[model samples]
Target: MSMRTYVTWAEMITGFARSGDSVSARRFFDQVPTELKNVVTWTVMVDGYCSNGQMEMAREVFEAMPRRNFFVWSSMICGYCKIGDVEEAKAIFDRIPVRNLVNWNSMIAGYAQNGFCQEALKAFGNMQAQGFEPDEFTVVSVLSACAQSGLLDVGKDIHNMLSHKRIKLNQIVLNALVDMYAKCGDLINARLIFEEMTERNSACWNAMISSMAVHGQCKEALELFCRMEKSNEKPDEITFLSVLSACAHGGLVDEGMEVFSKMQKKYGLEAGIKHYGCLVDLLGRAGRLREAYALVKSMPMKPNDMVWGAMLGACRIYMDMEITEQVAEDISTLNSSIQSGNNSHYVLLSNIYAASDRWEKAERTRIEMENEGFQKIPAHSAFMPCGA
Candidate 1:
């Protein structure tokens, strides 16, 4: 009822929300006297629900509020964006009486993160047009959009604008720049920026290593990863994934195995399904199909579509119908939706069967896929703009 109690309740709710205990936050919020619930308290409750992905609860809290602030409005926008409901986020953004930089950044980030690169770029333009100077978060989000859409020219323009305005590039902005350049196939520029950075954090190293692996510079990627370790930066899951991918591409079987072992043994990071998939791909590329299959069988966790997909791809490459059939049987046992959509595994199996001169088996596979209600998804390629 008092101002002191109000402040304490607000802080407690915030702490609970930050710790992912939305139930406690809501309970605590309910205990606070209705008369004591200020706009800040209401906003915190709304934010807690939003952070926990309980949009219905968030909206209920938001709608029930006697008063709303800029932060609550921004939280709603952010919540919608996080859940990939950009249309709703945009609606909320449009309804804001006045928007701030945080609101604008949240909108751009939502669009970019959910693969709406063009919308993100458009929103970035709108924000700048409204005279809100792009901050580090804004710059990074916009650059990520550029990277996702391969808008190299647009990214270059942003970089030039930053240079023109003499804005100090922080680590995140620099990393975004490197990512944008690298994803746009401008490895030269990406590397140049990477080499010039005085403060190379784990993220900076990850950007370069991933870029190199993606562009088929497997040897260079591995070398950069080694340099990352020598600089005393600890490799996280992303770092290992990139390193394993590089080994797979380079056909470095021994190196890949060592890295895979090091991940679990030395670093104490569990090798996730993706790491297992990369290792399988590595072994498969090296004509170690049986070993790959054995590893899959021995996995601690259930193999997902990616892991199985990697195995199937290897089976197809080696024309190993035996393993292919086994993979098909294994996939059939799972309650996954792998067979419910445009099933690549089924198609791969049919192709493998046909490739091995087993037309009947191939036809049988197709029939089975059809029975499972899966149609082949047409292959498509992404279209990049000219000179991008």
Candidate 2:
């Protein structure tokens, strides 16, 4: 190919990377002359593959490169992290000749994303020990890990670092901070950050609203959501889920329904299984069992385990054996087809049988679950430490 043609292909590959079209990027890459495939081109392709969840393909490109630089290694590690392969990310990290802030950030992000909050913090500590300063991405990753693990003290320390260092909070960092405080049950700090943000994007609003909701501050969450509307910011599916969950927790049935309807009509966002689950919970809590059942039945998509579990809970409350049996059947069918659905269905069905004084049936369900080697474990959150 002529130099002009090669340059055009390279530019096309850059466009594909910018647009997150990894497939097209690879297609364009294949047309590049072997002699003309520079490190920059390979880095772009690696990044595009990572962003598009093609981590293995990214690895192939990374390995095939004539020479690998820090950026190339960081790109592959970040890709592995993005796909929740923390171990693979760490392996890449282990091989890097020199680790930069970007390298540490990738590992920190990987640990945080994989629910290793403590690990992420440890990684930050190690990064500092190696004479590297924590940047915005570092702070964001650690704060997110704190949020997931509810480590208030660690979160507070990070907050202090940000303030002492005078690190201006960008939207992403600010959102992570808000989430951390909220999960740690410090709504005051969460609110302070939320109010102090100079430019609040939709994600900022969603994080604040979600933090409030999860912390049981439904009234405050609702108020903030309304304020978001007044600010003319459009709510996404996540925002609606958080707001509806708040209403459901507070038993604000009317408000929940209004929000649910608004999500569909105003935002043009279709209600997914999660939204339906929240609505069902709201209606079930209000003793509108029949209405909840009808809503579940009328859903355009198939009701998942969560929906049936909510319905079954309501049936147990109302002692409605007929619908309980129907829900049990649905649960069983769902279990037979989908592997992950089995535990929740079995648990719900056992609870339903137990509530109705059908001890024998409940016992049978337990035995069956045990025979299938389905043991439900209590959920626990942990933080892992990542190192530079």
For each candidate, the alpha-carbon lDDT, in order, equals: 0.86, 0.82
Q: Write the per-residue lDDT of candidate 1 for residues 1-388, one digit (tens) a residue.
A: 4455678889989999989999999999999887677998889999998988888899998988887788998899889888878898888889888888998988899999999999999999999899988888888889999999889999999999887667679988999999999989999999999999888888888888887888899999988887887787899998999899989988989988999999889889998889999999999988899999999999989887788788988997888878888887887788344544547676676677777778788778767767876655323212112342
TM-score attained by model 1: 0.91
Whole-model lDDT, model 1: 0.86
Model 2 scores a C-alpha lDDT of 0.82
- Candidate 1 wrong stretches, greater than 4 Å: 1-5, 338-342, 374-388
Residue 284 miss distance in model 2 (angstroms): 1.7
Q: Best-fitting candidate, measured by TM-score?
A: 1
Model 2 clashes, total count: 8
| Count of backbone clashes, every candidate in sequence | 0, 8
Worst 10 residues of 2 by lDDT: 377-386
